[model samples]
Target chain A: MSELVKVVVDAMGGDYAPQEPVKAAVEAVTERKDIQVILTGPEDEVHAQLAKYPDYPKDRIQVVPATEVIQTAEPPVMAIQKKKDSSLVVGLKMVKRQEADAFVSCGSTGAILVGGQVLVGRLKGVERPPLAPLIPTEKGVSLLIDCGATVDARSSHLVQFAKMGSIYMENVVGIKNPKVAIVNIGAEEEKGNALVKETFPLLKACPGINFIGSIEARDIPSGYADVVVCEAFVGNVILKLYEGLAGTLMKKIKGGLMSSFRSKLGALLIKPALKKTLKSFDVTEHGGAPLLGLKGLVVKCHGSARSIEIKNGIFQCVQFKQQRINEKIGEHILEMADTSKE
Target chain B: MSELVKVVVDAMGGDYAPQEPVKAAVEAVTERKDIQVILTGPEDEVHAQLAKYPDYPKDRIQVVPATEVIQTAEPPVMAIQKKKDSSLVVGLKMVKRQEADAFVSCGSTGAILVGGQVLVGRLKGVERPPLAPLIPTEKGVSLLIDCGATVDARSSHLVQFAKMGSIYMENVVGIKNPKVAIVNIGAEEEKGNALVKETFPLLKACPGINFIGSIEARDIPSGYADVVVCEAFVGNVILKLYEGLAGTLMKKIKGGLMSSFRSKLGALLIKPALKKTLKSFDVTEHGGAPLLGLKGLVVKCHGSARSIEIKNGIFQCVQFKQQRINEKIGEHILEMADTSKE
Candidate 1:
């Protein structure tokens, strides 16, 4: 039998709470013998939810009772520190103690980010851990790093993000080399604000990574680069705007198609093909965002995530473990340091 | 007859060059007797292009000879200083001398921005001029201020932007008490970078403007705020991404519809309705970006602009001149100072 990849699931997090997490855990363990899941939440509630899946592999799934549930509205730092027995904190602790290879949550973004950093801790020589999410593009998917964690990141931090992002894309996403590009307002090296101006040359000169030149936000959807790097504020704006505009446009298109009987008939004929095409662009199918550069992998799924997203996120962790992504990142950082010295 | 709003057209500009500019100028003159257009370029070329439209309103259109042309790749400051006889520089100089009420260009963005500030100059007490472009939204449109200008702007500069954006939206776009918003990664006041945190309170306290709280980029396309304000970098990302993602999606939709015979038939039936719905989101159907806070109005159309965009840009300048936008901005600046003192 193959070795099991142990992943801790926060059963009481997200909008759907213990129901979605418990179902996802059962589905994950039932589908794969090479994986084990430890669900952390109130034991009675988790067991009740898990009871629905009678055919789940009882030997692979375990429950670690966590009595407290962290709400999404609480302050992130304080919640992580105070709610020691909360599902989110307890699950992160399991990762910290090496009891689990990875942790997955669909809780408040702030709480998860804080818990990932303070509890899981950063890898040695990693300047900052970036939350890199796979955004849907025309060519497939591209990783957008620093979507929320570090707002005022320095140039050195950006260089580290590039190295780590390249490793993630190459190993987990199965892309070779994975072209890295810095986000800028214009393509010219001298055309950006002070932060971008400072970072551009550093990224251009950095060794061990295939650093492409600046990419404007306009080219992102066309999949111009595999890994797009930017400060957290800009990255957040790009991610959110991408979601907002796509949603708005899709709704408008649907409204247009339903306005008249002729178009309505047309919509019926194209519904199946259109659904398949649009489903590829759905972000949830791509899985959760992984907080890279951590001692152990930590994935933050959307708060409104369903069972499908949670299942994908679990599978993502299995890949992370199988590919040894963290080990590769550690070695890359050491090599980068050596290159800087030479 | 109403007074003629004289607008200077940069004939030696954009991808289509003298032909499109000359044609647009002729069309503008023919469409309205209340407007006159002065074409600036090599006299022979301008006259030759104008000859294509022999039945155009000859009395309302005129030409001024310019011997040189500024390429888009040249350094903006250097081009504006050296290319005195270039069509762009000559047209700007005309605005500076009050020979025309406004200047319209499909030239280099950098050169136009530099020339507008250096030649026509900022209004009294105006800190920095912003490039305000009307972006099409689900509900009409919203004005995105400082799209490519004023990077690394201060809190005070943002406050100024909100005030000016409010004025432009109210006067030109005719939105009453336009809801002004500062773009942020999160919707909370304390949930932004240093710049947004500092500016939020000031905007809330500042009188004479309708200052709404923070707006996430996701809400921008739904037209949540009439005036969406941000530093140039973030604003540029939002603007460009909006265009890029929309274009990519539309192409993908078309490709999907053509993939099969049933879908193809559906596409044919829905063609007219979808075309009308999609046309409302077209950026060109709106006008050029107006460089606000200038003593004389200057509108910069897209570099790839055609006759339709140029004609709309000409009419945009007429509105600015008719509404006395510059004079209103001047008064707003003075009023802001009085409120600050209190």
Candidate 2:
């Protein structure tokens, strides 16, 4: 039998907590026999949640004790340092020690960002580790890199991000020479500010990837390009606004449907199809965002993530492992660096 | 009657030019007795369109002669400087000379931004002319500043934006002591980069406005904020993403409803309610974004705007004039500058 892909999940984190992660882990292992999950949290709470899911395999699931919890309010660096037994810190250590191939968490994003760097460390030649998420676009999906991880990034970092993001989308997401675009104010090369103008030429000159000129944020969801690269500040804004607007619009639609008796009846008749359509827009189905340029894989799920989100996150790790995404990224980086040296 | 609010519109601009703008102008003048519109384009084209609506007051509508049109492809600066008979340049010159209360265009955004500054100029103490648009929120709408004018802005400029945006929202939009927030990666005061960190303290120190701390983009449409302030780069991203996602979701919903006969029937029954709900999310209904901090009022309608949008853009000018939003913003700036001295 093939070796099982071990994933360390921080079960004590997130709004849904042990229930969501535990349920998701059970679902993932049941669906895939080649994976094992280590649920890190209070042992008793983990087991109690596990007892509810009687159909889950006993050997596939194990509890790793992590008594302390990191609240979102605590300072990131300070929390990671002070709470050594926190789920985020402990799970990250497992990935660093190679006891698990990857770490999945819905914990405080700040703690995860800090712990990922302090514990798992960044890959060589990577100036900053970026949080890259695959957002669903009209044409399948595109990767949005540097989504609120490293702020105040330089132009060179953005150039590197385009390269790293290009490697991930091509190798893992399975797009060939994916169209990489620098997120800018306008499509014209000369349209953006200092950072974009400087990075545009560097991205265009990149040898191994397909560098598209520029993409405005409005063009993103239209799936106009395959890879969208920007600094963390801009990326975060895009990701969050996408989420907020989707949620708001859905809410408005529902409220409008329920406004009158005739509309309410119509809403009931169309509920099934509407539900199915809306499901595609649910961000949780895409899983967690990967901390790109890391030595080991680290995915940050939403803090309010539920069971489905957790399962999708584990599935993401499986894909990352099968594709050997990190190794390919590292090789690509070295190749680019060597060429630049000459 | 109150002094007639004269609004000069670039009638030759936008996708549905003479037809839509002419219709909307007639509607506005007929509905509001205190407003008059000067439609600038070819006199023959304007008169031929006006023939469709005989009930509209002939005296209330006047045709100004302009021979040239500014295509979106034309270089904005060159079009403004060289095309003396162009609708955009001529209409803006009217506003600059105070022959009209405001200038409204659904033409080229780049031309509007450039023309508003070079032709109309900025009010005293106004560092940058920000494109402030009223975005649909759960709590009606909130003004988002610096949507696409100034990038690479400084702390002082942002502070000025907060003061100006706050005044516009409260006075023109009729919100009281509007809550202003600097769009940041996170909510913490120390969370963002140098610009946000520096501007945070300054905004909080300013009087006459309810200064909220930083707002993440995800919190925008949820009505968690009233005025979202940021540099043009970030603001542009937010505005574009909002429009794109809303459009995509609406399309998906329509597609899903038509996929099955039952759902299509349901769609018909709920069409009115759905239309009403969707109208709230429509960008056109909110009118054009004002280029705040400019000496003369300038509003930027969507490039794809028809007559209805043009009408709203002109009507927005009436509110700007009635509330004297610019004068109040100027007064607030002096107050803020004096307070800083103390």
lDDT against the true structure, each candidate = 0.92, 0.87
lDDT string for model 2 (B22-115, tens) is 8888998998888989988988898898899979777888888898899887888998889889888888888889888888888888998999
**TM per model?**
0.98, 0.96
| Model 1 lDDT tens row, A3-71 | 899999999989998899888999898888899999999999999998898787899999999999899
DockQ of 2: 0.77
Interface RMSD of 1: 1.0
Every candidate's DockQ is 0.82, 0.77
Candidate 1 lDDT tens digits, B228-342:
9999999999888988998888888888899999999988998988998888888878979999999899999988899889999999888888998889999989888877788
Residue pairs that clash (backbone atoms under 3 angstroms), model 1: none
Scored against the true structure, residue A300 in model 1 reaches a CA lDDT of: 93
Error of 2 at B37 (Å): 1.8
- How do the candidates score on chain B by TM-score? 0.98, 0.95
Point out where model 2 deviates above 4 Å. Answer: none
Ten-residue region with minimum lDDT total, candidate 1 chain A? A276-285
Q: Of the candidates shown, which would achieve the greatest DockQ relative to the real structure?
A: 1
Report how closely model 1 matches the true complex, as a DockQ value: 0.82
